[model samples]
Structure formats: structure tokens, C-alpha cells
Target: MEHIKIGDEAPDFDLPGDGGTRVSLSAHRGKIVVLFFYPKDDTSGCTVEAIDFTALKPDFDAAGAVLVGLSPDGVKSHDKFKKKHALAVDLASDEDKTTLERYGVWVEKSMYGRKYMGVERTTLLIDRDGRIARIWNKVKVPGHAAEVLAAANDIG
Candidate 1:
């Protein structure tokens, strides 16, 4: 599938999220949505990113945006991570890789000179009208949540 671009309607999906609830893109239609995909839970980079997003929840809320983190991890893993970090934002489990494929973040990766398939840390800021406002692909965790918050603040 072609990657979503700015001005394109963000693809919608309803998937199981932390706390055993389903979260859908359309559910946040009237709000800016920050859809971020990460590789795993509790890993160094992923944990840092998640905590950063959690720390910026109020800023994002003030900017009228909701932060949603996606990963191939199951509900149990999400629960553990959220509980461990006391995360304020929603964490969605995409174990089936369905949503990941639709967004086109799942891809081939290389490490230790070996190739594998994994998620490319990416974030998409969807405007209140459902159009994608910006995309941060191959994300660098440092200061990323703040960057996203700034973008969301500028959308209006």
C-alpha cells in the first residue's frame, strides 16, 4: 500500500488497545490524532519514546490532539508497559499486523548485518478533519513528542 501523505485521509481502524478496549481512528475524527508506531514494548528506545509521550500528554491535550501508540505487541504487553510507565496516552495493540500494513510502517530492517522485518518507528499527525497533517518517519525519539505537539498546535 502507498504510504499515507499530508492531505490524505488517515486510514481508519478499530483495534484492541490497553485496558481491553477498542480504539479507532474515526473515533478521534474531531480531534487531532497522533498515531505513532514503534517496534516493541519495554525496549530502550521504545520505552523512552513512550515515556516522553506520556510526559507531554497535557500539552497534547491542550493542543486538542490525542496520542495513540501502536505496536505489534499484544494487549498483555501493552498493559504491562502502561502500568509500568503509568502512561497517560492510549496504547493500541496491532498483533495481527493489519493496521501496520495499512499504514505501511512494517518493513525490512537490518541489524548486526542481518536483515529482518520490523516496524519503522514512525509518527503521523492527523488533523481534526481526518486528513494527515504531517508524518515523521524513521523517527528519532529525542524531543519527538514535543515536536509532534508543536505540529499539532500549528495545524489550526
Candidate 2:
């Protein structure tokens, strides 16, 4: 698995989002993109992260940034989860894990001595030029959204 480094051109990918709309990084060129990847939808940590990001949507927008969360879940799952939480952030479905793999967020995780492949909570900040500005890997959910927001706001 090749992990992308900062300054690399943000990989362009199109995936189905909550409303059956195809979300693509290329489409958002010349715009700051805040892309976060979580292990699953509706889970405790993921829920907190999603809600936090949603709460800061206005601030992100004011800073000219787009926020998107992606997971290895289907569109239907994303729809239910967003509706359940009244989330305003865009959620993309990556059931085939193609985008996740491309971004290098999918990896082996272990719990209680058991190992399994899963999404490693990660976040990437892509500048308006479509190059990666920052990356947060194995993210800690608490205060994460705010941190990312601060970074986005600094994108001048």
C-alpha cells in the first residue's frame, strides 16, 4: 500500500454519495477539500466525527472549503446514517473500497488480538490547486473536526 504524501496531487475519484450523486475530487478543482475517511458509518467514533464536522459546515463554507466523509458503506447506509443524525456534511459510499485503497486509508487493524482489514480513520486537506496540503492518519475523533476547520481557514 502506497501512502500519499503531502504536496502530491490529490487523487481524483468519483464515488456515489448519499443522494445518488457522484462525488469527485476532480469536479471540485480550485477548491479546498476536506476529505475524511472513517471505518464505518453510524458507529460511536464515526458518529462523533460526522456530527462535529456537520456542526462546523457553515464555518467551512465561509472558508471556501468542502467537507466530505467516506467509508466502506453503501449509499443506502449513508442515507440512513445522515438522516438519523441530521448530518449536513456530504457522505460518500465506498463499498468496493477502491477509493479508500487509492487514498491508502484501508489497512489491517487489530482489536483484542484479533486482526482485520478496515478503514483507518484518516483525513486529508486538499488545497485549491488539487494538491494535498495536510494529512491526519489514525485520527483521533475528539476535537478533530475543529482542527481541520482551522487548517482549512488557513488555506490562503
Candidate 3:
């Protein structure tokens, strides 16, 4: 797992996305990129986080930022989740976990004394130059999207 920090160039990825589209970090050059990695699609926390980001999509757009929600879920699941919630943000699928590992969000998690591998609920703000501006790890759903928007606005 790579430990990416502020000022580090974000690892670029091209993955299948909802609506039969492909998402790539490099494709949004010259724009702030918000890449939110969640554990799964349609889960409670993930759903809230996705909706929150979706709600703030216009603000993010006005700030010259592009938002993408990523998980290990397949494109089919992503399509369903987006349609079910009417999400405005793009949802990328890292079915093989390659992108997840590159971002260092895939990890071993313990729940009820059971060990499992899952996403760490991380969000990264990539500057227009492709360098990381901010990173939120172990993200809490409440107000997280707004916080990220503020950060994006700050950097712009």
C-alpha cells in the first residue's frame, strides 16, 4: 500500500463507472478532484456520504472540482446505487481492488472480533496540478462533504 501525502501526485486510475462511463483521475486535469472511497455501495454510511456529496455537487462544480465515489463494488451495483439515490456524482468501480490498494484505502478491519478486508472510508482532494491538497481518513459521514467542499474552495 502506498502512503500518499499532501503534495504527492495522486495515483491515476481508469475504472468502470456508473452509467456505462469510464472514470480516470487524469481525465479531470486542471480541476480539483474529490475522490471519496467508501466500503460498499448502498450501505448506510456510504449512502449518506454519497448523498451528501451529491447534494453539494453544484458547489463543487462552481469551485472547479469533480467528484467521484469509488468502491470495490461492480459497475452493476454502482448503477443501481446511483439510480436508487439519484446521485449526481460519478461512482467508479474498482472490482479488482487495484485502485483501492493504490490509494492505500484497502485494509484489514476488525469488527466484533472478526477480521476482514475493506475500504477505510477515505477522501482525497487533488489539486488542479494532480497533487494531493487534503486527505481525510476514517471519514465520518456527517458534514464530511461540506468540509471537503470548504477545503476545495480554499485551495482554488
Candidate 4:
């Protein structure tokens, strides 16, 4: 799949999310949306990223934007992660990886010199018009949510 680019319509997807809700990307239309894709539910990097976003939920909400996290983990795992971290943002389970592939975040990785398929940490900022405003690929977990929020405020 091709990478989602600015000005393109954000692909729609419905996945089982944390808290027993089904989250659809299209449902967030007409609002600024932060779509962050991570590798797993509670790994070090993913956990840090989730916590950061959760901590900034108030700021993001005040800015009239919503944050949604995605990972291949099932809804059960997501529930555990959120409970353990007291995360404020919603997490969606992309167990089938359909949404991840559409955004081009399901990618190759190298760990211990072995190549494998995994989620390449990424974040997409969708504008109020349901169009992609910006994309942060190959993301570094630190300070990423703040950066995304700044961009959302700028583009929203």
C-alpha cells in the first residue's frame, strides 16, 4: 500500500478498540484526529508513547482534537495496557493489520540483525475535512505526541 500523504483522504477503518468500543476513522470526520500506530500493546517504546499521548489528552481535547492509538494487539491486551498505565486516550486493535497496511505503517524491522514484519511507529494527523494534514513516519517515541498536537493545532 502507498503511504498516506497530505491532502489525501484518510482511509476509513473500523477496528475493535479498548473499552469495548469499535473505532472507525471515518467516524472522526469533521474533527482533527491523531492516529498513532505502534508495534505492540505494552512494550517499552509503545508504552512510553501511549503514556505520553495519554498525558497530553487534556491538551489535545482542548484543541478540539481526538487521539487514537493502533496496534496489532487484540482488544484484551489493549485493555490491560490501558488499565496498567491509566491511559486516557483510546486504543484500537488492528489485529488484522488492515488499517495498518492502508497507512503503510505495517513494515519491516531489524532486531538482533534479524529482519521481521512489525509496525513501524508512525503518526498521521487528519484534518477536519477528513484529509490527511501531515504524516510522521519512522517515529521516535519521545515527545512525539506533543509534536503531533502542535501540528494539529497548526493545521486544525
TM-score, every prediction: 0.98, 0.98, 0.99, 0.96
lDDT tens string, model 3, 1-156?
A: 999999999999999999999999999999999999999999999999999999999999999999999999999999999999999999999999999999899999999999999999999999999999999999999999999999999998
Model 1: how far residue 153 lies from native, Å = 0.6
Candidate 3 local Cα displacement, residue 71, angstroms: 0.2
Q: Compose the digit string of candidate 1's lDDT tens values, residues 100-146.
A: 99999999999999999999999999999999889999999999998
Candidate 1 residue 85 Cα shift, in angstroms, is: 0.7
Tens digits of per-residue lDDT for model 2 on 30-124?
Answer: 88999999988889999999999999999999999999999999999999999999999889888999999999998999999999999999999
Encode model 4's per-residue lDDT on 1-156: one tens digit a residue.
776788999999899999899999888888899989999988999999999998899889988899999999999999999999999988999888888888888888899999999999888899988998898988998888889989988975
Give the number of the best model, judged by TM-score.
Answer: 3
Native-to-model Cα distance after best TM-score fit, residue 24 in candidate 1, in Å = 0.4
* 1 or 3, greater by TM-score: 3
lDDT of each: 0.93, 0.93, 0.95, 0.90
Evaluate model 4: give its lDDT. 0.90
Considering lDDT, which of the candidate structures 3 and 4 is the better prediction for this target? 3
Candidate 2 vs candidate 4: the TM-score winner is 2
Give the clash total for candidate 4. 0
